[model samples]
Target chain A: MADRGKALALPVTLLLVFEIWARSAHLHSDSLAPPSAVLAALWSAFADGAILTATRDTLMSAFAGLFLGGSIGLALGILLGLLQPVDRLMEVTIEAIRPIPSIALLPIALIALGFGYRMEIAIVSFACIWPVLILARAAVREIEPRLMEVARALKLSPADRVRKIVIPAALPRIFVAFRLAAGIALIVAVTVEIAINPIGLGAAIMAAQQGLQADLMLAYLIWIGLIGFGLNAGLNLMQGRLFGRAALVRDRT
Target chain B: MTRPVIYWRIVSFVVAAAFVGLWQLIANLKLVSPVFLPGPDRAWASLVRGFTAGDLASKLLGTLEHMVYGWFLASVAGIALGALIGSSRTARSYVAPSLEFLRPLPVSAIIPVAIAMFGLTQTMALFVISFGAIWPMLLATIHGFAAVEPRLYEVARSLQMSRLAVIFKIALPSAAPDILAGMRLSLTVALILSVVCEILAGLDGLGHSVLLSARAFRSADLFAGVILLGVIGYLTSLMMSFAEARLLGYRRGVL
Candidate 1:
């Protein structure tokens, strides 16, 4: 724990330096608040429970989108993996669609669904599905062919084959996709809020900035950062618990 | 394609055509609102208008200029600082937590800070882009440097190579693959950040155009702007992959 504190010293020192600079540099304005002021802002927001409320909204939407997108992507990817005909039929469309960033879909969502929670969740899911689909497909493709031969020799039912073989093999890759998609889900959700919906930290930060509440804006950023860190760390811990650290797949493709 | 590949291509084409047909049918027949999902022809016409009748070319050029310069600056600084940290255990130990803390901050979250400091100018966009991009490249570079074989360092030391010589001659070449990988990640992120800043800040760019068209109820124009973004993203990735192949190929003495 002490060593860990040593590793964190640089960041703590940097924040201290920024605080000094903000107060004394003669360049400070409404846009740049000292650390003390930012802490006060954060404390006030926390004390009022505004921070918790916003965090809940952001977390709920992001998780809902991730679950929706991940399941569909996994199912589609397995279908594509098992059937060559289906894979070939969908390859061109999937390839074309996957490269487009999710943020690019914001306008279409805005027009179609309007500025609401539905549009935000739908676009977040859309942005998230591709990574899961692509990686899951690749993972299944990477499965050993001899195992299939053995399953065929055993005359196993297709459902049994999938249950026993495909999912187990694809679990690591699926975890990787989930990790990737988790990040995307947060990003897309926040962006949608910032651009159109105005429901979460994204909106709060933007509102604060526009209102020239620099301390509050900075406070919001710190919360956003903490949420992101917690999500990623939790996912990693889950992955490690399920599969052991050694078996984790780092590269998706 | 040969006969088998040709058959696959035909199947894929049919699937794609069916999707377009469905979209057009729903959009044109008013089963769905045209404001939501414009027909293919309408979107195409909007894209054509964007290119030929509007100033999309200039906005695209502006976005590209900001993205390229910002990403370049980030790459240079990230690699340099990463090399320094990775070369020394003490430096890495002190710096790693700071970097890890900053890494998880969403790129969109920082645009407000950029706006506060620089307003809605090109500089603001560039700052956001570079700031978001730096972490990936830095992390990757550090990994690359740490992965360098200790034997190589010993070999250089025995040969009386200077410290700078050791870094440039031995460390960098060995780390090139990972560094290139980092560059790819950073550049893709920079592209995202660049447009995002435009959208949030109301600066002149594709993202801005998309927002404007959507708000104006010009669904075709909105979809066109969205499609153009896909194209830009696709083309950049294509270019990056090609360059990566070339660089890796040269490293392998195959070019």
Candidate 2:
């Protein structure tokens, strides 16, 4: 309880100071908003369903991109991990491509796919793929040699070996990869919206900024942060439930 | 093992060649519009032409300048604050909760706030970039300093070493690896935020150039800008790894 009080002291004091200053100064600036005003803005936005709608749009695109990218990365990572020759052949190519920031692909994607969900998903997918691919490949490669020996001893076919042995062994790490990819997907999706696409929470922030609605803009920013925090917390909970202490241990690095 | 290593190199070379060959073939065949999907040769040509005749070099330099500046600021600030928090049990307990709350907030979300406060200016970009890039380094520094061997502090106390001296001599070197790792991550974050800022603010950088070319439907120029950014990213990471190896040289083979 004392620790909890210590944690809240700084933020609470800071917010109270800001609230008093804003109220006393009557600083109706275009950029700065008081805590109380921000709270009020958040409340109204929620009542009007604006925040909910923007969140839905953002989540839809983010999840779509994550699913598409995660699957492709999983397949490619598994193949590369399982096949020594293929992994060797692909090393240089993957390295060459991986350094290119996904945001840099915005221009190409925009020109090719035009504005809207398709373009945003393409960029998010591009961003999400690398983490999964790299992590999954590492996880697969790190599997115990004895496991492969067991598969061979059982005379398991190649397909069965992968299905029964490789996947199960690697699933936990791969799930961690997906969690990382999920974060990337949301970030890239918001970035796409902020940069060009006019949908979702990022677009809302941009719109509010342009309108000089500081309270609204802050509200949206806070909302997005909350969404991100919630997503991470939920994933952590799921990972804990699924993999127990093992997932938490792997996550630190 | 050596034979397989040579074979792997050869296979990699062949695969790369095939990829370029296929790309050129597709471009020549006009399977996709040249406007949208230009050949690799065209991209190479445009890259060369942009450097020689166009203002691409200046834009590239501007981006590098912005990225380095922001990254430098983040490193200094993150290290200082991290040390202060990490060295004190009271400060760490109070500050850590706020950091935990803030860390997961996507850096991109802060862009709008920065823009609102500072408008479309280099100062805004620098602020946004530093703010975005600071977290990894700060966390790493805190972890590093806090995890410093208790015996080291005991020795410092025995010698009557000053607090600042103890930190500079003992904490900094001990924390170098974690700090370096965080710096590497922050550099990437700096680059990404710099690009995002340039694109949004119409700054004179490769990002703005790419955005402009795309808007004008100049696919080749856009691709060239992208390729250049990729090279920059690759080179920076390469340099960082070298720096890491050099800085941590004393620990070589010990781990």
Top candidate on TM-score is: 2
Could you list the CA RMSD of all candidates, in the order they appear? 2.5, 1.4
lDDT of 1 at B53: 90
All candidates' chain B TM-scores are 0.91, 0.95
For model 2, what is the alpha-carbon lDDT of residue A227? Answer: 86
Could you give candidate 1's per-residue lDDT for residues B76-165 as a string of tens digits?
Answer: 989999989987778877887778767877877888888888988888888888888888889887877788999999999899998789
| lDDT per residue as tens, model 2, B1-255 | 699798888789889888988988999999999999889999999999998998889999999988999999999999999999998889999998889888888898888889988999999999999999999999999989989999999999999999999989999899999999999989888988989999999998999999999999888898899999999899999999999999898898787
True contacts kept of 1: 0.73
Cα deviation at A18, candidate 1, in Å, is 3.6
The interface root-mean-square deviation of each model, in the order shown, is: 1.6, 1.0
Q: Indicate which candidate wins on DockQ.
A: 2
- The digit string of per-residue lDDT tens for model 2 on A110-206 reads 9999888999999888888889898888888888999999999999998899899999998889889999899889988998899889999999999
Q: Assess candidate 1 and give its lDDT.
A: 0.83
Worst 10 residues of 2 chain B by lDDT: B1-10
